[model samples]
Target: MSSSNARTQERELTFEEVDAQIQNADLSEFENQDDANAQSLDLAAQLKKVCSVYKVVKPILSLVGNAPFLPSSWKSAVKTFNSVMSTICV
Candidate 1:
């Protein structure tokens, strides 16, 4: 009835049309072994990078572990380091 109401109705209809198109579209093109393997390799590379960083930081973490609550100035850093270590250990 009003201009605002008409605009709202038009927007709702546009969304419904888009949703219907997406629901009816074919997705068979993405179902391939090569695609799956590529995704797996990418994930493995990312995990390797994380593991490398952890290895480099692990000794520093162990040194910190020897001093859990050294001083107030270092408490925040120590707490954060310990928290991260605990999370990694779990």
Candidate 2:
């Protein structure tokens, strides 16, 4: 066999080894996504508190909603913002 073929076989993994590597990668990806989701929820909670304290909904919406070609989701987000702002301050 040629030296290149010998090197290729040496670098190749068995089916089980490749499967294990793929599983590890998938678990790692899931863990990273979970971390990102937790961070997003935490940030949203923090922003909600800040908005409640400062009554920032109108200003926030004005800044973001005025952009051209806003999505339908943004319109729903605006409604949510309005609802959030409507809560009676303690």
Candidate 3:
């Protein structure tokens, strides 16, 4: 094999070994209930922000009655925004 090809293979093997070590490590040794609770609280705060936005926008959308296209667009926009927020919360 060429030197570049050999180097690439060596790097791949090294990465695989590191990944295996990480996967096999006893993660529970580093786990902490307090840390988990703090993360949960942070996520709750983000969810509250999304809920507030939904409440504020829904009333505006309701006022735009009889405008089928506009309402459909607003619905789609809200769905997309909520999906993005949910992904970040996770």
Using lDDT, give the best candidate's number. Answer: 1
lDDT of 3 by residue, 16-74 (tens): 54455456555452345475654666766747654544433333332342245666777
For candidate 2, write residues 1-90 as lDDT tens digits.
569645633553345544554454423322334546656667667565555443422334534544458887886787566556655322
Off by over 4 Å in 2: 1-53
Give the count of colliding residue pairs in each prediction.
0, 0, 0
TM-score of each predicted structure versus truth? 0.32, 0.29, 0.28
Model 2 Cα shift for residue 82 (angstroms): 2.3
- RMSD in angstroms, all models? 20.1, 21.1, 17.8
Of the two candidates 1 and 3, the one with more favorable TM-score, higher being better, is 1
What residue pairs clash in candidate 2, if any at all? none
Query: lDDT of all predictions, in order shown?
Result: 0.51, 0.50, 0.49
lDDT of 1 by residue, 1-90 (tens): 568645743432343544554566554433353846646667657565445455344444445544546765575676577567546543
Off by over 4 Å in 3: 1-41, 64-66, 69-90
